[model samples]
Target: MSTVPKREEVAKEFQWELEHIFESEKAWDQEYDQVKALIPQLAAFQGKLSSAAEVNKCFELEDTLSISLERLYVYANMRLHQNMANTKYQALSEKARKINVSASEALSFITPEILALTNDELDALINNEQLKKYRHSLEEMKRSKAHILTQAEEALMAQVSNISSSPNNIFSMLNNADMKFPKVKNEKGVEVELTHGTYIQFLESKNREVRQEAFKAVYATYGSLKNTLGATFSANVNKNLFYAKARKYDSVLDMYLYGDNVPTSVYTNLIDTIHENLPLMYRYMELRKKLLGVDELHMYDLFAPLVDEFDMNITYDQAKSIVEESLQPLGEQYLSVLKEGLNSGWIDVYENEGKRSGAYSWGAYGTHPYVLLNHNDNLNSMFTLTHEMGHALHSYHSDEAQNYRDAQYPIFLAEVASTLNEALLMDYLLKKSTDPKEKLYLLTYYADQFRTTVFRQTMFAEFEKIVHERTEQGESLTPEDLSSIYYDLNVLYYGKGVKVDEDIAMEWARIPHFYTSFYVYKYATGFSAATSFSKQILDEGEPAVERYLGFLKSGGSDYPIEILKRAGVDMSSPEPIQQAMSVFEDLISQMEELVK
Candidate 1:
């Protein structure tokens, strides 16, 4: 029997240098104490933020306290994820959470206080040299004055912010912690333990029997909890509605979109365009069915590998060199920084017992971005490395160029960097491959990216919009309602080429992204934008690279749509999405020709 190795058993080189953040547990504790002391100092200037000097003092102190709190929080959370069962780190994590809440409560008065001032008063205050640095922050606050509530209401809202999150928290606990899937036999007829991590591997197995069995086993567990899961999701939707209504937004979608200044038309346009172009998705599905030679393709068959895996296993070191070469269009400075990070202890490269299962690039303002990857020696893992390094490089560029206040980019713009990296890597691989089978596989993989990222996520986005609209229109969302809505969507999107299985309806119950309404659309949009950006960078070279870097360095200073516009892609219009669809269609045309 094979078991996950402990963190101690892993070589030190593969492990991340957490000591770079704080040096030791003693140092982390000292910073935690220092953060606690600063929180009170932050609250001292609360009632006196009217004058420019007072505002500057408040901003400085708040910035200091917030950055410190984030450093402490990231350190604790990363440590906890490294070994969740370790009680020492668990306690440290809990302490960090408590301090974060305290910091939130302490700074709660600041926003309402800023909103209390007249626009003219704010304009005059921001003109002072000392306070000019916060002009963007101040202007953002000023823009939201209409949505900002009274101080009393804001305080009440802040007090219950943690409570509002209970539904998502409860759902997470139920899904990640309490949920258990029954063991399913592998292709060799050996029963293996089923888990969230292993379920994807099962779905991707070459054996049809294994895929179908794992699919049934996992959903059966969720099917049993349908009512409870439905309740939690309903509560979360209503929670979104509560906030939307309170904030005076027209709908929950508007409320969510308002944060990044994305137009409602962008969301509606994606659905409209996708509806018009879904036949392309159907064509891809038909090709899949024909290639696999299945009588009827079930939903479980979607993730099976298109071509056999042979000599495609890429070691981590090989992946680094390939990624570095693939990203050469981004220029020398970008490559230099990325190479340094790849060589240094900037990534926790392999998974250990209790380590986080997925990949992410994370760090605080004062530190180099760090990545956590559970790498397996496969093409998929190779792409995951480039995807995450995409995020890390974006963070690195932003941190190097912007001040701490402006370093954090919004989630709306976050995925573009990552997906663009994927496009570059895919293009590089296609150019380098000579084997017909390998080229077919790479083209199939690229087509699948569109099928999944663009087509599938739009389906999810449409489902979210419908459910939120229903709830907003005084309809209660039940388990049957959610399942039926989701099932109908599958039929509509997948068309008549495939059978929409009954168990697939219960899929909505298992999707965690639904809890965050209107968020999935960004994945679709980001992929489209990234496709356009990658094409330009490949064709236009240095000039395109400069534009892309400028957009990354801009951070949160501008709205997401405006930022993309500066990067040579206007997301508000449908041109980018249209071009992306054309690219997908062209790939399908190329694949059909090659395979024939």
Candidate 2:
């Protein structure tokens, strides 16, 4: 039996250095205590914001307290992610969560108190020289003044903040800690434990029987808990709906986009444009079917190898080097920081028992970013390496260029740099490969990215819109309803040449992104924006690199749309999506030509 190693069994270097954030549990506890003490000090500034000096003082103290709280929260949660089954870290994480709620309740009064001021007073603060560092924040507060609740109401919501987040936490605990899958036979007929980290590996297996068995086993596990998963997801949707209504937003999507100031049309236009271009998706699926020579292309075949004998097995070291070389277009300083980050204690690089399943780049503002990766020696894992480092470097650059008040980039723009890294990596490999078969494989590889990131994620986005709207209209989604919605989308997206298997209906039960509602859409939009950015950088060289970096460094100082506009891609317009679709079409044409 093949099984995952325990956290202690994994080597130290592969683990992220949590010591950099908190030297010891003692250190973490001290900082947690310090942040709690400062929350009361923050609350004391409740009724004193008339003068510029007082406002500036209050803002500075709030920044200190907030950053400290962020550090505490990040450290504790990351510790838990190492092994969710670890009871000690779980308690530490919950302790961090409670303090975060307390800190939130204490600080919630600031926004309402600021909103309570007269228009002239607000305008004055926006232009106040003493508060020059916070001009953008003040402007944002003014923009959101209409939704800002009274102090008492904000405090009440803050008190219930942790309760509202219950669904996501509950799902996380169940999915990561408690969920178990029986071992399935591998391609070699050896039994291996089915895990979240290995599920994709099995799906991508060249052996069809192995793929089908893994798929059935994994979903059967999720299917057993379908009702529980459905209720959890419904609770999450209600949480969003409740907050949206409380904030006086017309819809949950509007509430989410309001932070980045993105319009609903941008969201709708993406779906509309993709719907118009889905024939390209059909064309790609047909090509896939022809290449694989399978009588029917089942859902499990989506990630199967398209071309024979073009294996790109990459070790983590090779993945790092290849990613670094691929990003050379971004210039030396970018490479320098990237290399340092890769070598430094900034990433937790392998999977252990009960570690978080997927990959993400995260860190507190002042610290270097950390990437969590469940890496395998395969082409897909290499892409994930570049993808996640893109996020880490984006965070690094933003932290370097902006103050803590503006350092974090908006979610709307978060995926741009990451996908751009992927674009560059694909471009580099295509250029380097001398073998025609390898070249064809790489082309199909990138084409599949479009299929997955753009088309597939758009489908997920549409599903969210449907489910959320249904819930908003007083329909609670049962397990059947969720599966039906997901199944219909599979038919729509892959119906032409693929089998659209029944087990795929339960696929949503395992999707972690649904927990972060409306987030899947950004993957689609970001792929488009990054395609445009990559094209510009390759064609225009230094000038484009400068603009792209400027966009990254702009952080959350401006609206995401405006930042992208200035950086040369206008996401509000459908041109980027259309351009991305055109690129996808070109890849298909190239593949058709090559096969001939």
Candidate 3:
């Protein structure tokens, strides 16, 4: 058995390398002082920005200051996130955040003021030799001229950024820090706490009773706080509505789809398509019910292992090789970067007490992308490794290829790279495994991916759309209202086969995405896009590989859907979603064959 160190011991053992950021804390402090001194200078360019020289000077100075401030902000926040209980780091992080916000407010007038200038004036400035350096930035600013608010309004928005983020912050605190769950007994008579972090593990438990009990216990806690959660959800919906109105958007949906240059049809289409596919999902549930030999399958039994649990245990070293081999289709340049990342400590690869739960890849421009994972040496963790590395490699390529302004891709396309990596890894494993049970497990696992990504996320998207539309129509949602809407959707998708418990009605309270305003739909869209891309890569080989790699390298230089289109996936069409559902159908057929 692996050693379980004390919480304090784990915190002491986990230290991130900040040398890439600054030589020392003293140096970071010095930089912070420099940023503070520069903030006032930024405020001096408030109104007089008509001249080309002035505009050019402002852009150069602001870019330098913003990049420096971001480095400090990212480093400090990452340090604090690494260990939330550390008061010193927490204080330092808060200070950095405030400093960055102040800097943003100080520089806020540049865009709006620039936007206020007539097209002729902007053209004159752009034509000037000095401002020529920022031609792309100027052009991009002009693209959003219609949406740019006045200088005063922009300043107001910047000042309120922290307050605007409060809903997500409160949700995080409630879900991760404050919430508690009852101890649940497994089939082996082992007691496990049903915390948010451990809930997934319990769902995957072999014992049906354990999974059901854990799900009930966890959702029951969420159900109790339904009122508070409703308020939080309302606050978030209001925030989105506020921004959409302020930006002159027809609706919040328009504002969200505006950023990605996609139409509302894309969102509605996923919902419509998935609604049509509900019977397929129900069929899968029926199969699961029969396989488990249960009278009824509860929502908890959704994640139970389909076969005897196989320990596809892999060491960190083995994981690296597996990911590299699986991703070989992307070519040597990609593999070389992965190798560098493995050697350069870009990954914090193990679970420890007090470390932030979950896996994610994060970094600032001009730094190596870093991945944080709670590696458990199982197939799930192995897939997570590849998934996060896909994000890191995407960031690496983008940061190398695009300018700082365009390097950060939107959330719409972010999942494409990550999920594509997962699809690739699944294909690799399925081909390598010949054992019937192992193959059955792998196929079932892939089917679950479809269920979670496509079915569950679409269900969430529909829930969000309904809640937002109701709020837009001047209706208020009580906790009961939210529960009823969520529960009905669950019944629609799960059908009459599975037992939809009353506690499952309150599941909406526990989901963080309800606060993100139509964000979950991307997971469904992304999976569809990934499925299409993965198939092309496997079928067409090198040419398709080139396009796929280029997609990763493109970043935010263009719209995400357009970028994927260039890479060989047309998300505008419903074909990809249909293809993903077909993959699910094939999996069901295989599982049926295996069970027979």
TM-score of each model, paired residue for residue? 0.89, 0.81, 0.85
lDDT of 2 by residue, 1-596 (tens): 54788889988878889888888989988888888777888766779987788899999998998888888889989999999989998998899889888878888778878888998999999898989999999999999987878778988988989899899999999999999999999989999999998999998889999999999898889899999999999999999999999999999999988888989999999999998898899889889988888999899999988887567789999999999999999998789999988888888888999999999999998888999999998999999989899999999999989999898888789889999999999989988988888889899878988998999999999999999999999987899999999999999988678899899999888888998888899989989999999988888999999999899898888889999999999988889999899889988998988877
| Lowest lDDT 10-residue stretch of candidate 2 | 36-45
Model 3: runs farther than 4 Å from truth?
A: 1-40, 74-99, 119-202, 213-247, 350-358, 474-481
Q: Rank the candidates by lDDT, best first.
A: 2, 1, 3
Candidate models: Cα lDDT each: 0.89, 0.90, 0.84
Better of 1 and 3 by lDDT: 1
RMSD of each: 3.1, 4.8, 4.2
lDDT of 1 by residue, 161-185 (tens): 9888988899999999999999899
lDDT score, candidate 1, position 414? 90
Give me the candidate number with maximum lDDT.
2
Q: What is the lDDT of residue 541 in candidate 3?
A: 87
List candidate 2 segments past 4 Å from native: 1-40, 68-106, 150-202, 209-243, 308-320, 339-381, 470-485, 501-512
